[model samples]
Target: MDDLPDDALGDVLRRLPPRWLAASRCVCKAWRRTIDERRLLRPDLLPLSFAGIFIQFDSHAFPEFFARPSPSSANTKLDFLP
Candidate 1:
């Protein structure tokens, strides 16, 4: 259900918390613009952005934190070694 079609991505962005949408912008340029416009129009999105930031910080601070690098960059770090 989370994987929305390209045509409906805007609506999905509207439903999601601003923070997730903001983070999602990194997914692509178009998505970032959509989320940025949505956030600009709706002040309520601020809280969601704040929550998003907190969640992001917590995840980054966790010992088990992990993320997939962009396909273009595969630099091996010690933490990712098997």
Candidate 2:
């Protein structure tokens, strides 16, 4: 794996499942560095963006909102005014 070019390595690493990726990070310093340096976080593999977290104050009501992944440029949390 180390023999591959950085871009090639990133392509391979980005396809790994999250658990395997986490384990791969533990393998060695070189692997860890490669993973961190490339930052191969594909859009489909990422978690939904942290737009905001809402909790309801009412005892009888449950609040719900769907989270969708935001583009890298727009990761801001704004208070939802009722």
Candidate 3:
């Protein structure tokens, strides 16, 4: 993996979801540099704003979810359980 050129690495890394891409910063200096330099984590670039979010803190089997709103709706604030 280390042998790949920066462009190749950036291409692959860009495919990762934005959250994971940010987490990858802790993986290593080289990858951090590539992600940072490419500015791939820009929030404005996200395809959609999630109108609904759901997560099960104790259930690892269910994947967390972010749902897009109906065309007539807009994103709303979410309050999670403490």
Candidate 4:
């Protein structure tokens, strides 16, 4: 494994599941701290664009809106204003 380049190892690390990645960080001091910081920093990195479409309708298409999925979670809450 030492023969492989650091970039190769980093590439493999990025493809791993979050749990395994976190565990791998514990192998050494630098590895542990790097992975720990990455986990903590992820939420702070948000995309520049946040956009969605809203299909508005009158009396005819109103019923269909209630049947659609509600997009709510621990962090985000959305309610239909209709």
Q: Is candidate 1 or candidate 2 better by TM-score?
A: 2
lDDT of each: 0.61, 0.73, 0.84, 0.57
lDDT of 4 by residue, 1-82 (tens): 6575555666667777765776677688656555555553253442344444455576666433234445675445356555
Which regions of candidate 3 are displaced past 4 Å? 43-82
- Clash numbers, per candidate: 0, 0, 0, 0
Give per-residue lDDT, candidate 4, residue 11: 67
Backbone clashes in model 1: 0
> What lDDT does candidate 1 reach at residue 54?
20
| Per-residue lDDT of candidate 3, residues 9-72 (tens digit) | 9999999988788888789999999998998889675467457888776765786786864676
Residue pairs with clashing backbones, model 4: none
lDDT string, candidate 1, 12-82, tens digits:
77776656765777887777776676553365554442211222456547544345444677666788568
RMSD for all candidates, in order, please: 12.6, 8.9, 13.1, 11.4
Query: Candidate 1: what lDDT?
Result: 0.61
Q: Give residue 27's lDDT in candidate 4 (0 to 100).
A: 82
| Count of backbone collisions in candidate 3 | 0
* Residue 81 in candidate 4, Cα distance off native in Å: 49
How would the candidate models be sorted by lDDT, starting from the highest? 3, 2, 1, 4
Q: Which is the better candidate, 3 or 4, if ranked by lDDT? A: 3
Worst 10 residues of 1 by lDDT: 47-56
